[model samples]
Target: MRTVRLPGLERPVGAIGFGCASLGSRISAAQGLDALADAHAAGVNWFDVAPAYGAGDAEAILGRFARGKRDGIYICTKVGLAPPQRNALLKQVYSMARPIVGTLTGLRRAFRRMPSTRNVSLPLTPQLITDSLHSSLQRLGTDHVDVFALHKPAHGDIGRDDIQRALQGLRQAGKVRLIGVAGDLEAAQIALANRDTYTMVQLADDPSAQPLQQLPPAGGPCYAVVTHSILGVGGTRERVLHALRMAGPAAMSEMIRLGYSPKPEQAVAELLLDRALAANANGVVLMSMFGARHRSENLRRVQGTPKPEALQWVSRLLAPVSESRE
Candidate 1:
């Protein structure tokens, strides 16, 4: 496993991390535990989890796996916008509201970039930040976590300053070793510039995100990079198929004709092993590995393959998209 030494945290973490988001919701407790074991045995030392992920069950399951061997792992957890309380009617309403709200918001944004359509932002107040961390610590069954990150904020939310300050306090209090942001492209660039305030930024590390290649190296306090969605949400195969079908048959055919091979999603992940090593990411967190048989194949790809030359050649083939977009 490749490793990057984060400055503020003073820990060298694996280049590939396991994200335990679907722990208790989709995968059974036994399955989740087994997956965690496999990841650990495979040299994945960094584990990322959040309360919003499986109605708090994800973190609970992670807590169980992290109990006896906390020292050997680097855990990162997030706070804000928790799962709705257990009220059947409320849960039903929430389930319905989520997709509707998202679709409507997308349509509204497409129609007009109106300020009125912005989402309500929650502030990371001193008490809220402190209390949330304490709760996460309890659930994680650990005293001090290696990194504490903030989830993506809603529109019009200016929570960065407050969240950074809260993270600083946590570092001072020895509750959190480093402060980071898990957000979109723009937010991550902003956080990267604010290295004195935030220690790391976690974001998508897809080929489309080539601009980040120019980010200044961790010169000062060493801003670590933790990437997720590197395989694209549903993994490469499914995501490319969707993009092609939705974008058009002509585009898909052009992509194929240009020498973009249709490798299984796992083969796509094999490409990332080298890229993660090259990018110096502290870790690349993947979602569940047992949700689909393809995912297990992906895990095997990450473990068995070393395809540096293939990735370089593919990057050359796709250079048009990478360069023209820039």
Candidate 2:
């Protein structure tokens, strides 16, 4: 993977980042550390973690694993509600609900526990952003973060000059090399367009999902771009092939039946890489390559065969659909 530059960041990061969301949640701490070590050894420089993941265990584990290698990595973390402390009741509630009910009720529970005012937080705000940075630094045992993002803000939270001011202050203090916002791209675009506060932007540019219009380059010096969920997590190959089958794409069906199989893992990855390149993205945050077997598979997919010349094909496939909507 090639490294790309972000204007204010002290170091260029690898094209593929390691997302730590699943590390402490679905995996054990020692195993997560092993995965981190594997990623680091494989030349992956970007690491993305969030407070909302694993109730702070993921960051703690990453900090332990990254102890002496601070300068060699680009550590990116988010500020948001920390994952709730797990309880038997909450576990039982989650297990007994239908999928939709589970989602809605879980969200409601989370919202209920969130601070009513944005200013009141996990550590309370004497300095707000600075306090959060110090807390993250202490946990990660680092002097500075390469990129720090406000994970996701409330709907009416826009135009909050206080938040903007706090982020700018972080940059000046050298606590964070760059500032960014993460969530839906539309909100990110609105933030970047309306304010010059952020140096880089992170968003998904995967093809399978409804195409999101890319924000035109911000010009001048800027962090290239970092994105996640580019593989369209839920848009697996089986789902896509099924859709194509239903639509009766005779050529595609023939290709499928003849064992001209486009491996789901490879095809989806290719689609992600293709779209990111199209969007002029510098790097992406990729997660879930934990086990040694999984790691080997990912490395093979990422580094094995030559990348196809896919831009032209994807453009032709998508142009008519986009044009029809316009």
Candidate 3:
């Protein structure tokens, strides 16, 4: 695997980082650990996890797996957004409903329909940031994380002095090495503007969704530009499928005429990975792979050379579809 050095980090991390968003929720502990092991064996040293993922179970699983190799790995966990605290019964129902929704979504995809989803939001208050970081540390069994990020905060939240000070305190206390902002374009822009406070920024990147042109230039305090959603999650897949459906009987002919394959998922993955690599060539691209096959495939794609001609063709073919969704 190819590796790159971020400004604040001492060690070089793999170009493709592992994302643990689906851990303990969509996959079992054994599977998650095995995937992590596979990734490590493949030379992936960076891992990203959020407190809200798996309702606080992903961190514990990652912690258990990081026991022997904690020093070698670059772990990043978010602080702002966390699982629901109240509504125990409702939370349980939601938890149960997730897998059911995922299964149904898979079935729907088999029939060329999109699955609806919802996101749970949390306040990015100073107290919440401190409390969440402490809890994440406890769960990970680590004294400090390489990077601690604000998990999808609003643009206005980044302007708060208390939040910045809290993160500064954590760094001063040796609890976190770097502070980062992760989420949408607004949060990323806020981080770029306050480069003195935030050193890293994680945002979504894909071929059909938010392209690289939309992001701020990387430099100054914002040395690390970590990207995710390369697999076209969050409606990208649905959008692509919907576009193909709209093409009707001419979809296959159009793909062939454009010098691309007719397999939508493969095409999407290839295009997204190519775009992500090109966009963040000097940084890290985060991806989630639950099974061995997927882990290997993604590793190969990231490590392999980019196909510029194919990428250009695919980009041109998908431009109209991408623009229509905007």
Clashes of 3: 0
Report the C-alpha lDDT of model 1 over 73-162, residue by residue, as the tens digit: 998887664653443443343344544533463552442233322222346676777888898898889898888877774423324566
Rank order (by lDDT, best first): 3, 1, 2
The residue-by-residue lDDT of candidate 3 on 1-326, one tens digit each, is 77788998888889999999867655667778988998899899999998877555789999998998999999999977655454354345445655564457565354223221223578777788888889999999999999999988888988689889988999999999999989887788888788777988899876665555666676444468899887676576566656655656576576557544467766556556766777678889998877676687778877764445545544545668666445
Residue 30's lDDT in candidate 2: 75
lDDT of 2 by residue, 1-326 (tens): 55666677656666677888655544567778988898789888788887655445678888998898988988888675556555334334433432443246356445345543112224323275677678888888898888888766553343367777788788888888878776677757756664567766667655554334566565664444667665554444335434444434563554445333355434434444554454444445465576676565454444432234444434434444455235
**Clash totals for all candidate models:** 0, 1, 0
- Stretches off by above 4 angstroms in model 3 are 85-104, 107-120, 209-211, 233-235, 238-264, 305-311, 321-326
Order of all candidates by TM-score, from best down to worst? 3, 2, 1
User: TM-score, each model?
Assistant: 0.72, 0.74, 0.82
Q: State which candidate, 1 or 3, has the greater lDDT.
A: 3
Model 3: weakest 10-residue lDDT segment is 110-119
On TM-score, the candidate that comes out on top is 3
Q: Lowest lDDT 10-mer window, candidate 1? A: 111-120
Cα lDDT, model 1, residue 113: 38
